[model samples]
Target: MGKIVWSVNFTLDGVVQDPTGEEGFRHGGWFGQFGGKDLDEWAKALFAEALGTEALLLGRRSYEYFVARGWASRSGEWADRLNSLPKYIVSSTLEEPKWSNSTVLKGEAVREVSKLKQERDGDMVVYGSYQLGRMLMEHDLVDELRLMVFPVVLGTGERFFGETGDKKPMRLINARTVGDSLVLLAYELVRDA
Candidate 1:
């Protein structure tokens, strides 16, 4: 069975809105301010995460942003792996997805994801799909959660965990500081074990 993995970079205040300033967000670009060994380690961690991802699950806004942000244009092993991977976008309103190996999942997200979790594929890595992530989490479909938590706090923005589905218990499998202040945290949903 496939596992749905939700991975994202978040601020200390739980904000996961736009990290880059290009999205016209007033408080964006906070993620790029860090550098040195910490940044390097975090980047390496990101690469490792991508390497393990079998597919990508994204939302409409995030899908457009990723394509516009030129993730496909960037030439490298990461770019190649990222762009070539099967991408499933949960958007009832989206007509066509231009990216390679991209599919627009028009069915209800929760039902579709439940079916997806039963597939014989590898892990399904979710990027910046806030609404979709919420739906999946709310439906108890997410198997693993990863957060690259930064040090700064943004008082206002869309948060990563504004509220979980319910009182779902999570087991912290791994937690470590990636850079100067960024912490890479991994948790598994405790359904049984």
Candidate 2:
């Protein structure tokens, strides 16, 4: 079976929105609010991991946002690999995808994802799909979580884990601090053991 893994970047106070200053909310791009050379390499490595992902799960908003960025035009080993992988978008109103290698979930996201996990394939990675993450968590579909915690905090904005009434508990699998204040935290859902 495959794993439903979530990889996301968040602020110290847990905000996960507009870390690149290219979005709304006035004050954005908090991820690079403070910077260093090593940090760049770390970010690159993180994105490289994402590129190697076999499949991507995204919400309608994040899917549209990413597709608009011309990810296919970017050139690199990572870009090539990322553009080649399959993407599943969870949406009701989105009738079509502008990006290549994209597909819409035909039915309930939880059921579709559960079936995908049952298949013999590679990791099903989820990036920046905050609302879909919450829904998956609610349905007990997420197998693992990989969070890159940045140094600063945006006093108000979207968060990594939203309100999902206790569908399952989480167990910390591993954790480490990278560079000065960044933390890499991984957790697994405690379904049975």
Candidate 3:
């Protein structure tokens, strides 16, 4: 069985809007704002994480945005792995996804993901799809929560963890600094045995 690993770059205040600044968000590219050699090196280290990911799970908007934006134009082994990896996009309206190795999952988000976790193997990562990731957490379908916490906080923006009513209990699995400014936090959900 596969683990649904929810991963995102978040502000210390929990904002997870547009980290790349491509979406024209007012406070976009918060991750890139920290300009330093340490930040550059930290970003380069993410390639290993991409290589280790078994598959990607995306929400409709994020899936469409990635397909039309950077990921479609990017190249090399990193791009190869990303583009070639199986992507399961949760979107009721998206009947046909144009990206290669992409599937549009039109079923109920929680049910589809629960089924996927049972059927697939290895780490299935959800990157930057806030709504989909949120739904998974609400359903108790997520196994791990991995966050790259940026030093800066946007007082107003779309939050990574909105008002999801579940109020889950999580145990800290790992916590470490990524660069001079950012910290990586990994948490495993605490479930009843």
Candidate 4:
């Protein structure tokens, strides 16, 4: 069985919206505004890992955004393999997946992801699907988490964690400084027996 992993770029305060120029968040393009040498180095490392993934589990919005230009438009092994590897999207309204080597996951998101994890053969990664991420976290479907903590805070925007009825405890397995102030945190969900 393959592990379900989440890789999300966030602010120091945990905001995941547009931080650069104007492409990240839906409203303001404040995501990459603070990207410097450190941020670049951090991004390179993150993309390297993302490239090694065998599959991508995305929400409807992320699926559409990624497929809009096709994964091949990007460089490196990740882009090449992503274009050829399997992509599973959780969406009810998306009638079809236009991207190559893509599949639309129907039915309940949590159940489908659980089933996929049980049968998958390699690394399965998920990007910024807050809704699906929350659902997966609630059901205890995720195995690993990679958090790229940025330097700035947007005060308010989309959040990585939401009210999922309870707090989920995680065990940190790895921690490193990527670029400048960006912190890359790798953690595992602690399960109670």
Worst 10 residues of 3 by lDDT: 37-46
Per-residue lDDT of model 2, residues 69-150, tens digit only: 8775787876777788888889988998877788898787788878877873777888888988888888888889988888
Q: Which stretches in model 3 have alpha-carbon errors above 4 Å?
A: 22-25
Q: Which residues of candidate 4, in runs, are more than 4 Å off?
A: 20-27, 72-76
- In the range 102-148, model 1's lDDT, one tens digit per residue, is 98888988887788778748999998788888888888888899999
lDDT of model 1, residue 104: 89
Against the true structure, candidate 1 reaches a TM-score of 0.92
Off by over 4 Å in 1: none
Best by TM-score: 1
Which candidate do you rate higher for lDDT, 1 or 4? 1
> Model 4 — which ten-residue stretch has the worst lDDT?
19-28
RMSD of each: 1.7, 2.0, 1.8, 2.3
Best prediction by lDDT: 1
Model 4 lDDT, residue 112, Cα: 84
- Model 3 global lDDT (CA atoms, 0 to 1): 0.85
